[model samples]
Target: MFNYPPIVCHHDFSKSDLSVDTLPKNVSFVRPHLQTAWGEFSLVEATVQAIKLLYESENPPDWFILLSGTDYPIKTAKQILTDLSLSQYDAHIHHQEIIYKVYQENVKMSVMWQMLAYRRYCSWNLFSLPFFKDFTIRWGHPLLSKPSPPFSQKLRCFAGSQWFSANHRTAKYIIKFHSQKNSLTSHYRRRMFADESYFQTILANAPHLNLKNDDYRYVDWSTKGAHPKTLVMEDLPSLLASPCHFARKFDIDVDSNILDQLDTMTLP
Candidate 1:
C-alpha cells in the first residue's frame, strides 16, 4: 500500500464477491478461499495455502506479510519499505520459546500469557482436567505408551502471534514444511489455536535464517481478556509513536474517526 507494488490478497469470501472487487490493478486474490473460524487449524491452513500459491507463482514476491482484514498500517509505505530495506533478518515475528509445562510465577509475561505458554498445543481433541497444574497433560497424552508430544528437545516448540512477515526464502521453507505430513504439521493440524504456533515453530526451527523477535504489529493487551483492547481515536498518538508498521483489532462501529485519521497518516 506504499507505492505501486504487486499485492496478493486472500479471504474466506465467495466467488461472486471476488469478481465484484474494486482494487488496484496490481492486486489479485488467490483461488479457493477456504472457510475458517476463530481458534481453528483452518486459519493456519488458509494462510499457509495462500503463501504456497504465492511462492509458486510466476512472479513471486520478494517479501510477504500476513495480516487480517481488521489490521491497518500505521507507518507510511515508504517508511515500512525503508525499514525492511535496511533489515538483516529473513523474517520478523513475535516469538518466545514455549516450555510446554507448568510455568513458574517469576516468568516475565503476565499471568494469562504464562498460562497460554505453559498450556500444551494439543493435537488430541479431548477434555482435560486441570489438576494441580504442576503437571500439564502435554497438550497430547503424557503416558509413554500413550500419545506423546510431537515436539521434543531437538524440535523445541515456539509460539507467538499468528501474524508475521517473511522473505521469499522463509516462505519457501514454510511451504516445504507444510507440504508433507511430518510430526510438526501432523500434530499441529489438530492442535488448538494452531495459527499462533504453526508458523512460529517453523520459523524458529530454521537454523539457516535470521529472524527478528518483533512482528512489527501494535496490539494493546493491557486490558484483561483473550482479545486485545479495541483501538480507538485516543490511541492515535501511541500508534504514531510505536515502532510497529501496523496496529490491529480496530472497529469502525466503535470509532470510525480513528480509521479516518490513520488513513491520513498512512496514505501516500
Candidate 2:
C-alpha cells in the first residue's frame, strides 16, 4: 500500500510458533534469546536487537516503529509514510517526569505512591524481605523520604508508554546508548517497567533529537486498570477520529470485524 519500500521488524517470542518461513517478503523475523517476563529488561534488549537487525538489512527502513503483536494500523501504509515524510520530528514519543509536580496535576498523592510501588534496584535479593516492595526511609527525621534514583543527577529520567516512532538516526542513537553500561542503562535494567521508561529517558535527555511528545498511537486510558481497553467494532468511529497512525490492544478472536472495517474504510 505504500509508495516507499516498507520493512517490518517482527520478533516472535511464542514457543508454539517460532517459524516464519511463510511470512511475506517484507517481514523479517527476529530471534529473541530470552523469554518474556515482567519487570525485566529482556524485552527492551530484544527490541534493540530487532532495530539493529533492521538497520543492517539490505533495504533498511527510513522509519522505525515499535509495536506489539496486538497493535494494528488505523491508517493505510501510504498514508503513514506521507504523513511522516512531511513532518520534521526526529522521534514521536510521549514523556513525563516521575515527580510530584507532574503527577499532582491530575493524580492524587496516594496514586503517585502506587505508581512507583516497586524499587527495581532491590531485585538482586529475590528471597529477601520486601522482595519487590518500594523503599522508604526516615532519613534522620520523623517523616519518610523517597529514595533517589540509582543514576546520578546528571542523567534525568522520564517515563511513558514503550511504543514509539522514529527516524533512522534516532534509532541509531538508541542502539548506541543501549550498548554502553553507564549508570543510566544499569539503573534502567533494574526498573520495574523498564520498557516504559528506558527509551523515554534516553530521547528526553538528548536535546538534539527534535523529539515530539506524542507517539501517534491511540490508547484509551479512561477505563480503570493497568491495561488499556481493547478495541471493538463499536470503536471504529472514534478510532478514525483520533487521527492516529495506529490504535492498539486489539484481539482478533474477540472482534475481527473491526479489522475488516479498517481495511476497507477510505481515509478522508
Candidate 3:
C-alpha cells in the first residue's frame, strides 16, 4: 500500500463550529484565515501554500489527494494509498463535457435576467435580499455572459467538480498555471460557481496533466437533480459494493450511522 502522508485543508469556521477532535495520525490539517470578497480564493491559496510548504520540506508525499471536510473515506487510507501507488496513470477525473445548454436555460435566466430586472431592488435591500446578494456575488462581471461558447473553442471556459488527486509534478503545474493565468482566473472569479469550473477547465485543458480515468469517488447522482445526488443510509449496500475509495455529500449531522456501517464493511 502507498504510504504517503495526507493533507486535510480544513476551514477556520470548523474549528469553533464542528466537533472534529483528532484526525488520523497521517492527516495534516491546514487552517487558513478567512478573507472577505474572496471566499473560495482563500481556500485555493491555503491549499497552494500547503502544497508548496510540503514540497519545500524535502519530505513531500508521493501524491496529494484534495478533499473537503464533508467528504468521508469509504475505504481505508491504506487501500487508497496502495491503489494509487500501483496504478500507472497520470491523470485526473473530469467531466468530458458539461451540458452548457442546461445552464443557459436555468442558470442564465436566474442569474442574468434577475440581475437586470432587480438591480435597484438589490441596491434597496442590500442586507435583506438574499437572492440579489447571491447573484451579485457570483456573476457580477461582464465575462460570464450567456450562450457561452462551446467547450472546445472557449479560450476561457469552466468545468465542474474541483475534487482531485495529483502527483507533485502536476500540483506544481497547477500553481504555476494559476500564477500565469491571471486574466482567466479573474474572469472565473466573477462567474457563478467558480470553484467547480476553475479547476476542472485548467486540469482538463492542460497537456501535461493527462487526466484519464475519473478517480473513482462514488457520488450518487441517481436522483433527478442539478447537483450530484446525496448519499443516504439506504445507499450503503451499493456504495460498499462499488470499488471506489470515497463517497461524498453524506450529511454529518443526519447520516453519521452510514459512516459506521462503511467503517465496518470497508476498513480493517
Among the numbered candidates, top lDDT falls to 1
Tens-digit per-residue lDDT, 21-128, candidate 1: 567777767677777777878888888778887777677878888888889999998898888878899999988876533435665445446446445463244445
**lDDT pick, better of 2 and 3:** 2
Q: 158-201 in candidate 2: lDDT tens per residue?
A: 77788999998898898898888777787666556688788887
Over 4 Å off, model 1: 14-21, 100-111, 122-147
Which model, 1 or 2, shows the larger TM-score?
A: 1
Model 3 lDDT tens row, 168-220: 77777777887785555655554434555666667776766667557667887
Give the 10-residue window scoring lowest on summed lDDT in candidate 3: 117-126
Model 2: weakest 10-residue lDDT segment is: 136-145
lDDT of 3: 0.59
> What shift in Å separates residue 34 of candidate 2 from its native position after superposition?
3.0
Number of residue pairs clashing in candidate 2, backbone atoms closer than 3 angstroms, sequence gap of 3 or more or interchain: 0
